[model samples]
Target: MRPRYTVVASLSRLHRTFLTAPSSSDEGFDFIFYMTNKAKSINKALNDAVPLCNNPLVLKIHEAMRYTLLSGGKRVRPMLCLAACELVGGQESTAVPGACAVEMIHASSLIQDDLPCMDDDSLRRGKPTNHKVFGEDIAVLTADALIALAVKKLASSTSFGVSPERVLRAVLEMAKAVGTEGLVAGQAADLAGEGMSLEENEVGLKHLEFIHIHKTAALLEAAAVIGAIIGGGSDEEIERLRRYARCTGLMFQVVDDVLDVTKSSEELGKTAGKDLIAGKMTYPRVMGVEKSREYAEKLNREAREHLQGFDSNKVAPLLSLADYIVNRQN
Candidate 1:
């Protein structure tokens, strides 16, 4: 028989090969090139920001942090941030630090999201969850440390040529996104609604929207708005990007709900159908699969519409991202 290591290697190769193939949205977007180059840059930045530590005392915690932060996943939040900054006539360098900060916060959120008390998942990013690998104690610390580092990264944005006022605004904005106003609120609502009747009615739908907006959309909104701010975009530009990111964020979870049942575990890089099995409230559960898919498309259109009146060339990344969100098979 082939060695176990060889089988794992083959599976990894298959995963990458499958992901490299073009999705239906590839034709209009050139998403492969755009995602490749941008994800490359973001990955490098993330690596540089979170280097391995040699101090035996703290090395394990640091390793846990780096493991999750550097794990395989699309750098969507950072890319959205950089694209939003460029959309408003800002340089990519001006946004890279903030982009990294957003990803750190996002990575931190993922760690917390998969805890035994939360989603209770055993897999993430196609591998073991942080708590599963690092122990729950260290996993919690990893999330806390990442969030702290993210704030520290953002606080130093002025060094990257962002204005003091803008940097302050961005920090405060991200704090709101992470705290009670955003992820916390959404997670609370989600936990409360879990395994209970909160679907298929106007009230349930509204509750679901609240969960999506706060849990997912809040951080995304912060990512774009902070990017726009760092890019020196005007008030109008920031608000417009906020609306766009909100729609895109909602569409992301909507599509995730659809993919959960439609795709396999390998395809999604996580436990597929687990949400349905867990009695979790998802778009498909509340709206049905077809309606959920239709809602995702509707969100895509609205997200792109918000970018109208901007330079087409500049908005290409955001436009492509919206389409990619709706059309991505995984």
Candidate 2:
């Protein structure tokens, strides 16, 4: 028989070969070229602002928070927040805290979603998942703490000096985004419906809409609306921003479904095709792949169109962001 080392080497080569195998549908969004400046600016802002949570308890929570938050993501939510603020004529400094708050909440949800009871993902952003690194109990507690801290930071951040009413509004919107009405409900439904079959009927559509609108789109909508509110935007501006956010949210989920079939685990920085494995309802699984791609592009166009009322310079990032969302590979 061949030596054990040789067998191991051969298996490694096979794994690499599998990963690099070309797919027929190899089109992937060139994210580096598309969002280079926006990504860099967002990262710099997040790194600088995240370290400022100075209280020991907050700092401990921030440690767990940074474990995942700083772990490399597209920074889409925070970018939405900052873009919404800028669209309303607010400076980046004035909006950084809200951006950070949204990011924290997003990170917490990711952590919870990766727990054993949920997706049980072992990796995220190409690294060991939060539960994998810190143990499930601590990971769960950490996520809970970060959620609370996000609200606390929003309340205390003096840069915005937002009215108590607006701050409360932000909290309520965030609660709706992440509470039973939002991400949590979506997650529960996703898990509960695993391996369930849906006929082409109204019930299927209801399940699909609930999973997409609540689990994915709600937080994104909150990010845009909250950023606008914090920046003192008018009612009309808020309405427009909501429309943009909802469109982008749906677009984001469609692209995610596309990526699930087209991308690899390494490219996604997490398991690919898990949606099918989990039997979760997805656009690609519901609509055919070609139709799903077309739908995503349509929503992307609509999202960009919603921003036309704002100054071109102010809305450039948001427009580019919509394109980037539909076009992302991972």
Q: Pick the candidate with the highest lDDT.
A: 1
User: Per-model C-alpha lDDT, please?
Assistant: 0.84, 0.74
CA shift at 150, candidate 1, in angstroms? 0.3
- What is the Cα-based lDDT of residue 230 in candidate 2? 79
TM-score of model 2 vs. true structure: 0.83
Regions more than 4 Å wrong, model 1: 1-29, 198-202
* TM-scores for candidates 1 onward, in order: 0.91, 0.83
Per-residue lDDT over 1-330 for candidate 1, one digit per residue giving the tens place of the 0 to 100 score = 433222233234333543763343344556557766777788888888877877887889889988888876777788889988999999988888899999999989899999999999999867889999999999999999999999988888899878899999999989999999999999998887788765344358888899999999999999999999999999999999999999999999999889898999976778999988888788888879999988988998889788896887678788877877776677
lDDT, candidate 2, equals 0.74
lDDT of 2 by residue, 1-330 (tens): 433222233233323433454322213433234344445665675576457476975565566667887776666787788778778976665666777778888989999999998888897766788988878877898899778867876776454677777767777888889899898998887777677776642256577778878888888998898888777788898889988998899889988888888889866657899888887778877786899899988897788778878876567667766766666555
